[model samples]
Target chain A: MTNSQNNSSVVDPRGPKPRKIMSRRNIILYGTLLVVAIYYLIPLYVMIVTSLKGMPEIRLGNIFSPPVEVTFEPWIKAWAQACTGLNCDGLSRGFWNSVKITIPSVFVSIAIASINGYALANWRFKGANLFFTILIFGAFIPYQIMIYPLVILLRDLGIYTKLPGLILIHSIFGMPILTLLFRNYFTTIPEELFKAARVDGAKFWGIYFRVMMPMSLPIFVVAIIMQVTGIWNDFLFGVIYTKPDTYPMTVQLNNIVNSVQGVKEYNVNMAATLLTGLVPLTVYFVSGKLFVKGITAGAVKG
Target chain B: MNSIEINNLSLNFGDVKVLKDLNLSVNKGEFLVLLGASGCGKSTLLNCIAGLLEINDGQIYINNQNVTWFEPSERGIGMVFQSYALYPQMSVKGNLSFSLKNAKLSKDEIEKRVKHASEILQIESLLDRKPAALSGGQRQRVAIGRALVRDVEVFLFDEPLSNLDAKLRTELRVEIKRLHQKLDNTMIYVTHDQIEAMTLADRIAIMRDGLIQQLDTPKIIYSNPVNKYVAGFIGSPGMNFLKGKILQDGKPIFKLEGGWCESPDLSNYKFQETIKVEKEVWLGIRPESVVVGGEAENMPVNFNLEIEVFEPMGADTLVWSQIGGQEFRFMVDVNTSINVGGTLTVGFDPAHASIFDLESEERL
Candidate 1:
């Protein structure tokens, strides 16, 4: 080729042209994302708006509109005065019951499951795989099918309709999945670290507490979020295992929203629904970053 | 007295044997390296000594006490891993002191050990920094520091320098050698890198297929490998092997397979056993042992070969050539001018060469 022609044909390396804001790819991608976001946000918006409105405003029945006059009376009533079953003391008692159930259940299940995971991941005594297989199999079993058996079991143990009974039930049901999560997460940590711990004169419990536990903050955050949300939002186990006196907030919420004794106060129902969800929501917000990291770390390996 | 002894150690993973009938003994204050290719069970042997792996059949002794059934911690050993294996969440100080605290040492003792270890490792300034914040070399130094604080009589290193870059690996290899000298403790280091084994080891156990092919000082292993496998595994450019047969008249003479050149005189060669008759053998000549140009004139066995390629490796140039249609290599000065397709005279004394029997592949 001629020198001038060769030089002219050689194009300088340049980046792709920037696409316009309204390109088809951008439109489709952001459109689907916006629709999905709005789909979830609309219900949350309606609940928030409905909870802020007074009874007369809620009666006007424009659910999407902002309240003409904001009132927190429904919230106060949901917390104190509103009746749940025979008690007119509102969800305060049930909230405390949930606190009692959730805190211990989360801690106990995590403590046991984390140790189970560490053993399964690092130390392979005989039958460890069999034990892990059974634990994982437990995770896949339908919770509904076990309710009757669990009720009988708890009743025989003389903890039926008690806070401790519900706590025990939550702890047991939370074990299999939490253990699986912890096992997968612990497996992602380099095996050499475990070996090094063993060589450094750290025995089983020492290694677990000092090495594995310290390095596993993200996974622990993940477990806490899972157990807190699962135990707090549970309606079936709480209702089945506890009586009205010790009913968790979720069960009490069902009583308030589904009661047939009086006028259905929409604002009070929304306020109580929001209050019931507040604990888990706060947990997710607080540990959202680590939640994503822990999930990806566990999923990518083991 | 021996610091660590392993007897009849055999470990199996189901049907696959990872280590088979392995026996090793390390002298007190000696630095022994287990050198091998990957999957050769070098690291597995180190783990067995550390009590990290339970042997299927064997006994391990540390400082004259049988520790076969002891817990890893109870075995009184410290280990560094290839991945450095530092506690990512803890500061360098915490990493050093965690096990000391776990052992229930007094706070003053723990602090004293940590300070001593960090100072010796030249990581005193990094004491408060977490592993994630440190560089690779710094992190590895901290890992070594962790082992140092244990004050164990035996230290196990499972390829601790394998993860570092080439420059860092050389730097850390020297540091490890220096550390061994300063601490005067028995160390068992496992690595696939031959150079590290050669430089850092007082003696190297060259392993293959879960068995140690040779165990001797680095100089002895280099100059007089017990078998062909070790002779081939130890050197960087690798020793050149010529397929030949040894015929005995009055003295042994190695006949080239293709009769490409005159048979090399082997009268001066040392034999492990007396040669009975004509036998198939491999004549191994290390690249550095093969003198080229004018120096080839005085050698016991000398020949001219056509050079096919040359590689300049900065310090020395490796010249690739052929002998009896087999590939052969020799090292020459980097400044030596070389051209492919040119004839070059190369020679090696059989005394410096290793001859292995063709059937058993054992050194003669």
Candidate 2:
């Protein structure tokens, strides 16, 4: 066909193809993404370098350079015996305590959130929508705000300064966000699914446990990561709600870095902070890949 | 294993009554299709029968028990969803075995059932892959396999083919038909596609405005729609309508006031319901029944009109024209020598035409 007859009026050779134009946008996006990437990396780099350096190098120098004298002493001190108050117990004590609080808390919170999310999205009972709106609003409220009443409530219930109390507090505090995340995720699931599940003779709990929970592994991993990180790095709740014995990694990190002294042990502080962030960070890195794939694959087009 | 009877089922989401006193029944082992446009409550009705939706006032009987409040599992039904909602974390074998696992069946029995279902759907190799690893058609097969493992008395399909590509849709449609035959259980399917309804349904229930307008065999629904809505919904290109005056006599005759076609002979049709109301009456004629024929004396009522557009669809061609400003369509053989802006004589066979009351739009 002739060029004129080719309908150039309807088609421009250089104009974007809906599919092909992504790479151009990706270059611009990735450039900006790189800058943001560096912004996060700088502080992490400072912490790492300071954690490895000797006392003299840590005191006198740029936070970016390699440590003048790298030593494993801070790592050991931070693990076994690091002083928060009178006792010089390092992050290791709180590290175990954090694990104890996080595992059960994340599992309970994520499980409740998934159930709440599915029920709210699929079943419409009396006052169900109002409950959801209230729950979402509750989740958005700054978690620290609840500490005052929660401390008194837990104290009166005679469970304050206990590990179970800390776990309970973590579950209640993390529930709103977990619930919101899960509900938003589940709302995107096709209604045909719930219908089909029921047809398979799945009851409400049956559908939730057998169908929704199984279908939602990626989101569950994400929820676990979020709750673990939030509770693991938690300072205010761990310090106030739990006893010294039940204090999480964040409290120990706080004592290691924030001890009342003129020149703090920057190396130990960095090492302790790194120690505190490991579990949540590890949780994130491990499941982050499948979390993304799960969200897109099982959740979206399905 | 058992028949389903839905009686006066009415459901409302807030003030909008979605299924307004809807009624339909599926005989034992019959593939009943609830066909309607979206929002016409076909899926809603199917959900109600599946015990997924609670009807405000109705009785759903499965094998003679009033199961209005029965739980879905207790009601013994299997439903295939349009989305093929498979559990992501589970292997295909795990997904197929899930319900059986819930039923506390022995592990060996569950394995045996899963193996049987996978072999039937020809998805045996995909047993180890998760739902995320499968394509759309494969996921759908797995979804069907999940339902098959349930081994329930009733099977419900809520637009299961809507998500598939056209070619895959045709392939899966045949697969589903074969499954239905092999399983021989009561299947209640809901779809908006008339072709799907025409091909798969043992009986088609045409729905409109939250009511079952007509529930009959596909042949009866195509040839004898209860009203204009049923007539309009069940055919591709749909039945054409024209305002015509009814001719007086026992044998019903209608004159096309501004139509190119004159009055046709309806000598065979005896208007069963005697009604003198004929002003502005609607005439429903299927495109297949109306055709391009020869001269006037050879045909009783005929139209000689300009062909505005022609669409050749391989097997047959659709010729569109306007008579008295009302658009009309007629089917012609694909090999027919016809061109745009050309005038052709089209004939209407009164034997196949239907008359509708204008105000009510119900077939008389």
Candidate 3:
């Protein structure tokens, strides 16, 4: 009995002599993660150092150099006004436009995606598999292929080159990926929960609106990051579909940096680039918490 | 008070039929377990009851209200998923209150219910933390809390305890049992693990190849299994089978290949009336029923054997040896001083053994 008790104590978590040892593989795993961390930090280091330098200082171009003149002017110039066109309004105008596009696009597209993904994953119907087939197939099609048709369609609506138009375009193009991400996420969720909801008198829309949508916030963040990045940095559709007045930050940034006559504004360009990346970057950072939470909560139980 | 009833239910995924005319009724407030091996359509059957999967042809009624065409949420059930499926963005309180929020209940009422649920699940301290902050068992409790907060009549658990470690599984199993006892709600649980079914369900339904092979109380499943499949599936180490023959003298005798004699009483059975045995039979014996080494003449059904292999478990030691033309295993006292190739008389108890028609594989 004493031996049994000793064995139980050793096997049990609270007692001494933890049986689980970090294997040799774990050391290699940590070493690999450390290497990856160094790789990921390299570009950010360059960006920060580059952002600190003036045009003349930038020309010297030692990637590791600490700027002799640590000035915030580039960041400021990118924010307030750098000449995108004759209208000296800087990256901020496009930044606001990106916000306008990303907000509606992310929410609308993600909402639709979660609903569609849930249906495809959990619900059954005759054409459901076909719908999934079409959607997955739609995801592989190049983004450029749909541009002409989409631009024409928006132009016919007369809301073309407007904020809503850009938002709509972003949503339409983003549907496949957003739906796909949510679908894969929801697939890992056991079917019993849906059935329990069904037996609880949860209708299709009821479960989707209440249980599934609420349970899908991680995929939502993932969708936000994807859509924000894709739509925020978009130039082709933004240029063709929107007027000069409504151009997003990417288009404006391009016009400023790409133009030969416009005096090259390196500091402003870098600042604008950082600003353009900021919303999606911020979204990724903020939503990353939820993403981590979702896996623990919704995907893995043990 | 919701009782789910399925009639003539069959579901096919593409060309493969996963469920075939499954007919079963789970009474109100009863805990029903669908136990089977993986790919046996137990989960599929549970989904059909939950109204998550559409039956190819059948009717599903919840509390006598036909809900074959109803949506999942409208089916009046609360389910716990194996993955937990807790809303990550929501706090434990938020996750618990979400369904109530969707039900458009007043905020105060939602809070009251969420509070009660958290208390019931013993997760009140972790209500404010996101799922990321909680341990696996805690997350599982929150999942149960989420299900409990929604006042559904039928509870569905799709292998909810599968993700838990063995110790945590035992802990949560007791908690689930307590919850069931308190709520007295109809619950349909699906698991590939028979032990879970045996410990939890009021009645365990065994499924094989999309059909329910046997449905009975745990005791009956353990002792009075209808076929070899049920007999093998329900018990740890399972029941053993040996080739035997029914004699003309109304005696069922098990023939041994390596010079062994075993017998189990078949005088009360009607196997001969159903199918002619023609001297071919299968004798089934559970390990615990058989004893090892004693006076050979005193034993009713005794066989001489050489212990070929032995496995020691603290309480009991398993003695495995070749008997008849097949391998046979028997459990004995752990202190049994037996070694490989040692000669000893193995005793078989006649009363606890079962006889089956060899060709049909059906218990007689």
Docking class of 3: acceptable
Best by TM-score: 1
Docking quality category of candidate 2 according to DockQ thresholds: medium
Using all chains and alpha carbons, the TM-scores for the candidates as numbered come to 0.93, 0.85, 0.74
Using Cα atoms, each model's DockQ against the true complex is 0.72, 0.52, 0.31
Cα deviation at A27, candidate 1, in Å, is 4.1
lDDT by residue (B1-364, candidate 2, tens digit) is 3499888888998899898877767799999998998989888888888777878998899988888999877887887888888877789988888778778899889988999999999999999998999999999999989988888888888899999999999999998999899989889999999999999999998888898888899999888887888888878888899877887665556766775446666676646577573556788888888767563335567768789999998899999988787888989888779999998888776767888888888877
Candidate 3, A46-159: lDDT as tens digits:
777777788888887676788899888888887786776577777778788877877898889977887888888887666988898899899999988988888788889978
lDDT tens readout by residue for model 1, B3-69: 9988999999899999999898889999999999999999888888888888899889999999999
Tell me the alpha-carbon RMSD of every candidate.
2.9, 5.1, 7.8
Q: If both were scored by TM-score, which would come out higher, candidate 2 or candidate 3?
A: 2
Candidate 3 Cα misplacement greater than 4 A, ranges: A1-126, A136-151, A160-167, A188-222, A242-302, B1-4, B27-31, B72-76, B88-155, B167-189, B195-202, B247-277, B293-297, B349-351
**Best candidate per DockQ, number?**
1
In model 2, which residue pairs have backbone atoms overlapping below 3 Å?
A82-A89, A82-A90, A201-B73
**Model 1, span A1-302: residue lDDT tens:** 69878775796546896569999999999999999999999999999999999999988878899999999999999999899767999889989999999999999999999999999999998999999999999999999999999889988999999888888898999999988998998999999899888877778898898889988988999899999999999998888888888889999999999999889999999999999999999999988999998878878766
* DockQ agreement of candidate 1 with the native complex: 0.72
